[model samples]
Target: MAETAKPAPAPEASAGPVSAAGAYLAAGVASSEADYAAAVEWYGRALSGDPANPALLQGALMAHVGTGDMVGAAKLAQAFQAAGGKSQIATVVLIAGDAKRQDYAAILKEQAAGGSAGAVLDDLVKAWAKLGLGRMSEATEAFDKMAKTKGLEAFGLYHKALALASAGDYEGAENILSGKAGGSFPLTRRGLIATVEILSQLERNPEAVALIDRNFQPGTDLEIDDLRRRLDAGEPLPFTIVRNAGDGIGEVFYSMANAVKGDADASFTLLHARAAAYLRPDNTEAILLVAGLLEQQRQHVLATAAYATVSPSDPNFHAAEIGRANATFAAGHPEAALEILQALARTHGDILAVQLALADGMRREKRYDEAFKAYDAAIKMVPNPGPGHWVLFYSRGVVSDALRHYDAAEADFRRAMALNPNQPELLNYLGYSLVDQGRKLDEALGLIKRAVLMQPDSGAILDSLGWAYYRLERYRDAVLPMEQASQRMPVDATVTDHLGDVYWAVGRKREAEYQWRRALSYDPDEKLAARLRLKLAKGLDAVLAAEGAAPLKPVAAAAAQP
Candidate 1:
């Protein structure tokens, strides 16, 4: 919503105006989809004809920054201002360039001139800009001022701690992080790792080891485990989380980027992410964050490139590779995704995330046996699994059901329910399966009813509930929920098909045929489509009779009542 994620592309009226119209609209759609490179390309094409179009210039600049091309953004910034455009993003990019060159005066001048991205951004960057000028007291006071503002205290205090640590004031940083300096700070991976490195700096290796153990479970990451082992063995850990004011500034952008991620437009999010990566090129976490934001934008190629920058020896390398695999998968290269995950499973077999990724890839490809085996491997990694592992059971249940091992599927679903008793998906799946088999009518109804209560807005769950009622011969009860489900999921072939069957059972013959035709139009799978055609040709009851089945009225209804 912020800044429309990208400028509206020009309309393509009258065949193609190429600029100020057609190409501009093309740029808008591309940028909106997070195809920044494509947006840039189209914007460039449009700008050649309408040189002073503020929207096109702004869109091009955003796309440039999204790809971490600060130089291109800076060049566009000049053109934007000359074109009488006031773009906050252009100003930020230029300010970032100044920060990169250690030109604090230039950055401060822009802030003084009322050119800023926003209040929090301006203050934090100004704080770091003061540090670039070697004015430690002024920088601390600036951070303190931001801390006094409502809702900004946490971010301010966290940055202040980073600045203090970078300025060789470990005691001040420790006081803030340990909550002795007032309010408690939110925990993050970077923040926790910073505390560990700081504790190590003070020669409190035992405390650091204890802190890591207390905050994180065993084997949280290979790097953390390595750090703990070294700490216990009395190795002196270096204070390298933030070595300079620029790195602290990078942390500022990275933190805010994470905070406003989904709420803000992807283009706006990339602005801060770009600054984080630019200010501290070696910060692996920031780099990974950049790739993640790009992945959300669906800029898969760029995400893959950003993720590939993290070295394998880095603690966050597996995290980066996982992101890369996902990006590859999203880019319509599931085979490439599978290859990365399969390699990761071999290299980091003990890591549950790697095993899960392999399993997920297999599941997506419909290679059920491989996915099941991978899930088994993943389940073994957790000696005593808890609620967090419920998804593993649920996913394996899906595979089991596809293979027609109903007993195994039911057991997995029930085990998942034990772990997460109120999980809607588990309830719906188990309930629908029981309903389909015409067994445990009361139990199935109870589970699905609870599921509907939890996720009343879910189209799929509503359809399941309706199908359960239909199986129980409560034709009248099935109609309303099925209608709602079809409306909610208008394109879902299965829901439409179920609606058709219910309509037929209730003697709405024309409505049933229309619903069946609508379902077919949605392109169902081959088997379902064939069965639907048979229903249309012979009618539901006649088709049942041909298969030596009981008529829809007495036998099927009686069998469902236990």
Candidate 2:
């Protein structure tokens, strides 16, 4: 046998001032938990006593930036750099500060001193700084050089197009944006909008309108619709995608944030996104990115605050409100979330997303009647429902089921299945519902079997399959799946209860009682817990007899093997 290892000794308690060691420890704990605000406060207290401690300064600096407190971070950056700290993040903060003041010479000086925000970003910033200094030829040359760099053609060409448009070279901008200069490059929503504006500036409003139509469906995006309407009316839209080099610099950070979103650490991505938003307050996309990242970090209050920053008159206001509602809900303010959606519905009822969100909020609150009506209103918005609309029907079916409108619920479920035949949740729900009601046993079994084949690891679906077998009096057939489901969802009250029932049906009386106790420990609902206690006290036979339920049919001894 292998020798057992002894536990490591814990650190001895510190005798230093609380502001020195204790504050530093607290900051580190908060930072590790991503509680940046608390970390910043603790770091401040620690730094008060230790001032130039490199680790304390670095921790404080990162905590400030993590909360998008650039002003505080800049001050910490100064202290950090003064004490010989060399951090890339400090360099970025100083660079952003210079960029904010439109001090192009300062930015160039920083770059000359070997300060960099990585290779690609450094090159992009150099080009934008050149443009800021009015060195048009130098900026264009730098952009062209970046375009020729293999695998980075899109970044250079896209920015070059924006620069040309800002300089009133509509033809040159159009050539690059329309992919006539070299080869086609991918365009983001902002890039597409820039191209549309450039086309309109060149007196090609018809082409701009057609481009908008090709990229965005009518009635889908309010901003796109507004653009299309203006273009159709023969309006010459101004090229405001990048009005100056400052906005261009902001775009660089925004682009970096988007690129690193899923691949990098969320805090790292948030730095870029927050920097972008700081440099250009009007960059709604950057703000949204910050809010979304905060939500992912479970900083729900911060996310809600960021979402609330979007102006009501802005085209993205609806999107922001929706995000705010979700963040509010996540922050344990479900009623506030419902209120936000309800207001959104009053203002933008024609929008499918708004209606769907409102319906979902009602459904979550168990306001089934209101939820069903809201879903009805949402379904009416889709003239011709397709596969993407499957969720709408599914949600309506769920609400209908809750309201005891079984026939309507079944019809809606069928419609949802027709739209997306292989959706495992839909299969499981319909099958489980049928099995629970003791109807359509064979069809229910087939549906659940198909669902299990698709999602074998789903504890809920496995539980449904096991319960179906129990209902069919196949005690032996029910055992394996019930045991597997119980293992997968060890703390699930319903699954534990089902496992207990299966055990009792198979004559494992002691195991049945053990599972029932476990189910009670997992906090089953009052009714479920009551029944479980009754079964444990009086046994399954008398309990089933009292409830007038069918008694378990005896199985063959060989078939009863656990």
Q: In order, how many clashes per candidate? A: 5, 0
Scanning candidate 2 in windows of ten residues, the lowest lDDT window is: 5-14
* Model 2 clashing residue pairs (backbone): none
> For residue 397, what is the lDDT in candidate 2?
95
Query: lDDT score of model 2?
Result: 0.87
Off by over 4 Å in 1: 1-22, 49-56, 79-86, 109-114, 149-151, 221-223, 554-562
Q: What residue pairs are clashing in model 1? A: 9-24, 9-25, 10-21, 10-24, 10-25
Which digits, one per residue and each the tens of the lDDT, describe model 2 over residues 167-223? Answer: 899999999989999779989998999999999999999999889988998878899
Question: Counting only residues 3 or more apart in sequence or on different chains, how many pairs clash (N, Cα, C under 3 Å) in candidate 2?
Answer: 0
What is the alpha-carbon lDDT for the whole of candidate 1? Answer: 0.84
